[model samples]
Target: MLEEIFREYDIRGIYERDLNETSVKAIGLNLGREMLKRGAKNVSVGYDARLSAEDIFGWLVSGLNAAGIDVFDIGLLPTPVGYFSVFNDKFDANIMITGSHNPKEYNGFKITIFKDSYFGADLQKLKDEAVSTIKAKTQIKDDFRAIKFDIASEYKKFIIYQFAHLKNMKLKIVMDCANGAVGAVLPEICKSLNLDAEILYPNPDGNFPNHHPDPSEEKNLKDIKEALKGEFEIGFGFDGDGDRIAVLTKNRNIKGDELAYLYSLVMKNPRVLGEVKCSQNMYDEIDKNGGKSFMGKTGHSNIKKAMKELNIDMAAEVSGHIFFKERYFGFDDALYAMFRVLELVQKGINLDAELEKLPKVFSTDEIKVETSESKKFKIIEALKLELAKGVKELPEVKEIIDIDGVRVRFEDGWALVRASNTTPVIVTRFEAKSEELVKKLQSIFMNLLDSIKKGM
Candidate 1:
């Protein structure tokens, strides 16, 4: 078992290379034991459309059963549906086997113990236990001992009923499923709602022949954007496991923070949570609109934990992970977010018009600098120290927010440099009042980061 697979948020790595039968079974066994310690009796397991999903599922189940925990196989489904199974009170714990917008050869597990995300320190503990005690030649069982469950159908019905109001709504929209797990249920839900929608790449293909299953990249939304050029009023694109979303109009691709701003328009005094990478405009706009905005760390697990602690109604990441607690479960679901966007449209709220009202600020998309996992956090620490000492080349510092990494607030804008919890990369973003300022801030920050990297 490679320790690198035990990430801050979840366990992920290349199949066979790091997540083969022996390693995956060991992970399942250890994870099952931890679940039992927490008083979890049974876990609902689901997988995405990854080619190795079935093989991994079998191995994982064998290990879980060896740990004396019951397993409910929810079959192929989106990550959100797996979350819904837990929130629906059908299982004590849940594990979704998905690559989650990663390359097809990669796969991983996203775990939920009851409603809480099983991550961070707990994940580290699991790693320690696996490394110290678990054996390399763990026995594999032929029988999976898993009971088949149709949670996907249940989740689809629940969604359809929840958004029954959108039935036969006169709105034209297009969806790009990216050939991931969302294809399993979204089309059926759309049909049941009688939505005038066109769905592209609805078939679940682990190969992802259409485009990469990530909608956050501008290139992936090309087909959907091209469809929007016709009579389609809106476009929605989804990532592999159907958790993240990209909302696009004829003019703009609405990001997660921007989506939160739009969702808050109809909400009364909404309590919204945003991550460090969110634009300054998002925070200021929400605050100015009678809503309370709070910044938290950048992972879904971090955001969800913060939401529970802060009693927040909504939370969003700029990369399209939006969570809601106002009227539904506070888990990130792109399908659920799609309905909410439809609700906004149903209320006659023009999506593009509402966005245009926000203060125009130039912002750069997340810029990632490749680095080794061991050096990423060290670089972040060095950058923070340098900023604290006040580098002359940098702009005047208003404040340094170290909630996650380092978000340096400037007089005109902000610059952020943080280590990606999942990947071996340093993530950076900059926002300013003008394009020129944005470029300048990015240049200075990158230069400082380069110096820090060189010194290390």
Candidate 2:
């Protein structure tokens, strides 16, 4: 029932403490009422491999039925399959019950209304209603009134058919599912396509017995990287809900922005979008190739919104949320991204060689500065004002992009400082043409941020 559970992206928190049966039911009721206000009648619902998912699903369905909304249960599946239901089956809305790469103890909902992300202010309003209007004494029983829907098989069939050309192509690939929801469908699709693939942790285990389901951290990719040392020519790692992907070659871990750059090479006048944390080389490379590139706010929902608003062909986040509007739905799908990577390889594009062709730049991974949720955005605002006054130790600022956070552009590179919308931290990254400059930028930015935090 805590207000902090309602994040900018979706409703998420520790399963029992913040998202209990009472609170989840309230959320479902409020969400259903909101949909009713928008004239939405029925919704498709799916849950991930979390242990608490089934219990939460029943509570949610009870509340949704109370609001006179019909539910189509898609059962255990990846988050993207829930999204697919809306596009393919023409549902009014969809809700995926997933923690999405968070710890095993966490669980929540990712909602899509009319094919658009139901997030940000809309989610905040639902929080207000759910907390204030609903009382504990309100007798809401666990009356599950959901009809069964088999969207998983349809989704797998769609993928296998789309990638039929790559069937038996003699490509040795390694995949690490991390015991997440992707295991529900990916292995079967690979087998159907006759792909010579080795899938690690292909069973859906809510306990996450192997490792954390997140692929963004290099530590989590240890097994896949080790497997690639022998016969595996390429490797892929997927997050819990199967919406984010980490692609690897023998020599390099191709980031989402880099993947966007690679995908653009095959398109005619490709218009691509990247988040604020993306390296400058990604933008520069796309422009150099006679394509257009743009920078937008970070987060999967924000990226998808920008893609649709700009009619972009593709979009990517540095953390591996890649969306394609060129040939498929404009939603982040790690499963689809894997096939796209295979398509690039099949077309004779050398993944590592294409990456090597780009201009070299030194960059640091996302550096998180721990701060209270109440103070994170304040720190960002204070730092922005301080930089506007011109810090003596920092380099001359060429431009300041504040679309999501403050990305201060310099002559050689840039430094980004943004407050994470989902967690209580400020995310920072630095990129420069040389290692020395990268260090200098990081040091200066950290000092400035420290000063601002102290002042606050």
Candidate 3:
């Protein structure tokens, strides 16, 4: 029973090792009890392509049933589909069993209740309850069976209708499903809309034999790039649970913030929200286009909450998590975002050309420094203290945003260093007007982080 599995964003850990039957059943029972306390009577459950997903579902349902919570099983589907079921079916709660972009040995649960993601304090409470139950050695007996329901077709139909204008766009499209949850729905949806797309790894393989399910890594995108080089005008890649997306032009990979910028061009008075990690150009461009722009804390849960509270039309993270509330539900759906991107191209908006038009700035991909989960946050705090002490010696700080992590703003660019909530590492990113400036900022921050971690 590793308590560390209960993460900030979701409950995740190595399968069998940390997410054994005992821990998982405890999680399910605690979650069910918590949902009931929140006035939730029923929950729609789903899983990704992982082989253990079905087994985990069985164990999870037992715990839920023991707590007298009705379970509506959507079987194997993307995480977003579980979110979709909650809205379209009016389910009181929803849970998606997925590892997301993590490796094969990892698995976890993403939970939602009353339209709000069950995270942060909710997760902490659940963890505490589960640990208490285990300590008390409570035996929960299963009482009810799960009811099977299919939401894939309905979700696909809804997406097709939402973006019907993109039907038969005749653009050569290539998609890499990465053998994740997208295999079951993405192809059929594309076919229904008459999209000329070539799908790679359309089959759902939990092993992910072709490549890793995460498309954010450049190495995992090699297949998609290969296909793009051979007659594909555009490429799309999805994470393990089909929530995050990686958009690719023939020549370049389009990032989430850039995608928001492109989407804003077609929208009338768009209100876009981006994470602190987003580029300054995205914020400036949205404001320049008569739209509202806001920078919020990084993380899907944080972005979603801000979007709902502020009535934001769209939100994005630099890591390719794009949420749309303009004409669709306010959730990060890669499949839906793909259509929006195609809609831009279908409506004569040049994909690459539009991106090229944005002010050019050099940026680094998310750089991770390995550290223990226990030490990661401590390192960040130490670095923060050091930065404050050395403020006079460092480059002039225009502004420092500590919404999620520490984002130091310089006149020319900015640098961010934060502890990754999902992994045992410190995530960092830097951007500046020139490559040299970006490197300089990153070096200073890296040195600070290294010294702090060593001290710890």
Candidate 4:
């Protein structure tokens, strides 16, 4: 097994080649042993719609059983529901086997222990254990005390009951499940609410025969945009495991920070947390409305953890990961966020009009620069050092926020360059008051980054 599979967030890799039976089994064994050491007796396990999910599940269970832990299988479900099972069903720990928005060949686990997500340093420890040790060849017993639980149905019922006020909405809505695990619960919730909606790719197909599960890319949103032209008033798209969302109208493709601003209007004394990649307008808008805004590091885990610590009402990333601690749980859930957005429509708020009211600014979507995994972080460090030394070719900088990556604040705008923890790429984004300034800022950074990489 390759060490690269052990990432900052979770364990992810190509099936069989990197995460073979032995590696996965060793992972389960190590995790089970760790959980048992923490006094965990029962653990909830769920998988996404990936083709190799079941086979991996079987192997993982064997290791868990070898470590003497009981597995409560929730079968196929979204990542949020698997997280919800820990709180609602009182499971000691939960593991969701999903790839989030990655391609079909990728699969990983998002682990939760006693309501706190097991990530960062905890994941690193698990990786150390899994990699250093060898798998035992002894034949383990079958029937690893697996119990089937219906978390999906229960989760669906909870959502429907929570948003019962939205029942029988007259708005024409469209949903694209992307043939991922959202198919399991989205239709049921919408149906029970009597929503006038059309569901696309409602079946959980591992092949993803329709389009790629990631909604962040413009190409993946073609189907939903087509349905929105004349028939549907609004459209919602979900990622593979259904934690992130993409909201689209006929005139605009709403982003996460924009959604945060819209949601803040309905909140009382709201306190929202946004990542560094979020636009300054979002922070300025929240401040204008007598609400507090805090900028934190990127990533769902980082955002969620900061929210709880600060007692923030909501948190959002530019990539459509919305977390609400105002009324619901503190984790990111696309279905839950969908209901919140729909509630705005139920209140007669025009989606496009409300967005247009915000201060206009030019922003670029996340642009990735290819680099080796070994050099990604080094490049960021090099850029930061160069910025500190004050290069002549670069634009005048107000300040630099090095929380997640290097976010250089120019007098008129800001540019960000960060190392992607999950991929071998440097993610960069820029925002400015004008389109011309935006391009100039981007070019300056691109040239500086190129020069730095060449020297390295």
- RMSD (CA, Å), candidate 1 to true, equals 1.1
Model 2 lDDT, full chain set: 0.91
Instruction: Provide the global lDDT of candidate 3 against the true structure.
Output: 0.88
Between prediction 1 and prediction 4, the one with superior lDDT is 1
Off by over 4 Å in 1: 133-136
Ranking by lDDT: 1, 2, 4, 3
Candidate number achieving the greatest lDDT relative to the actual structure: 1
Tens-digit lDDT track of model 4 for 81-156: 9989987855899989898899899998888888777889988889878776553454444435679888888899
Candidates in order have lDDT scores of: 0.92, 0.91, 0.88, 0.89
Cα error of candidate 4 at position 160, Å: 0.7
Instruction: Please write out the lDDT profile of model 1 over residues 335-410, one tens digit for every residue.
Output: 9999999999999999899888888899999999999999999998888788778889777789999999999999
lDDT string for model 3 (207-314, tens) is 999999988899999988888888889999999999999999888999999999999999999999999889999999999989999999888888789999999999
TM-score of each: 0.98, 0.98, 0.98, 0.97
RMSD, every candidate, angstroms:
1.1, 1.0, 1.3, 1.4
lDDT of 3 at 18: 87
